[model samples]
Target: MPRYSSRQELVQEMRKRARLFIGEFEEIAEQDKDTLLADVDRSPAQMIAYQLGWMKLIQQWERDEQAGLTVVTPHPDYKWNQLGPLYQSFYETYQDWTLVALMAEFEQQVAHMIDLTLSFSEEEFQQSGSRKWAGSTPANWPVWKWIHINTVAPFKSFRTKIRKWKKIKNGLERIL
Candidate 1:
């Protein structure tokens, strides 16, 4: 939810949140990545896949636009209301990978996203309609907003989810 005025600030926050999110998963056992609990909506592996999915989608939109192709918001196969199915596809896409591999991919994707973000100009970060794909949304967010929404925002939110998951797994909570 933090608003960044500069690309440097955006990247800094992105990297910081990513570290915090990934750090939460470090202590989780690889064998337990797919273990679903009674409370948490997603498993550890699902969390990584969800992040990876959105990051890849953002990169794809940028790549498609840069290549002079019509870029899709979300995807051609899915609409805004179809997000649940889209997320399921994301989980299925990376389900076979080990937790360690998913984490590595997530880290790598974050780096790639940061690099892509740096390629934009300060003006582009502030101005709406900078990218057709980004502008297509009802919110009409700029490129930086898209990046922050997919990266920093979710990283912070999901970090909390992972913390709760860890607490439950470790039985570190009280019934009160």
Candidate 2:
């Protein structure tokens, strides 16, 4: 039997999960410059970039679909390496947003993508061609899972971080 459901519905679930990330993102943003600068194992930007990557792929898929440009034959720019540049460009352009707001944009973009793809009829969706999809980066076969993973996983991470940071921030605030 052929598989069904173009995307994993993970992004949709992630939309809810992303909300849990907001509080953590706020604490991280509110971190004293000293704390963030001293412990530089990773930047918040790095974490945001990962989510940005998934959101971007969703955005691109939506764009192509709207343009009626299906069958995304693999091209050099469409490669994984190219994804970094697109992400960096987004960061550079949207540098003003706080982490929470950026997360909101991420949620919005993914939701738009899911709305676009989820509406596809079986005939339109199952047209498996030379198309490159977000899930295509992992294993093309489990595109739906990739979609869900990309959409939901980051938000879950965001939520966990938020919860931890909020607790810490609250404690720190109590000390003052």
Highest-scoring model, lDDT? 1
Candidate 1 segments exceeding 4 Å error: 172-176
In model 2, state the lDDT of residue 41.
27
Error of 1 at 19 (Å): 0.5
Error of 1 at 75 (Å): 0.9
User: Per-model C-alpha lDDT, please?
Assistant: 0.92, 0.53
- When summed lDDT is taken over every stretch of 10 residues in candidate 1, the lowest stretch is 167-176
Query: Whole-model lDDT, candidate 1?
Result: 0.92
Deviation of model 2 at 24, angstroms: 3.1
Best by TM-score: 1
lDDT (tens digit, per residue) of candidate 2 on 1-176:
22434434443455566656544565565333113322232245545655776666655664675688763523324555675565566556556566666657766776675675566554445554334553344555334444455656666765555455446655777999
Native-to-model Cα distance after best TM-score fit, residue 45 in candidate 2, in Å: 5.3
Clashing pairs in 2: 7-144, 8-144, 10-148, 24-162, 72-131
Error of 1 at 155 (Å): 0.3
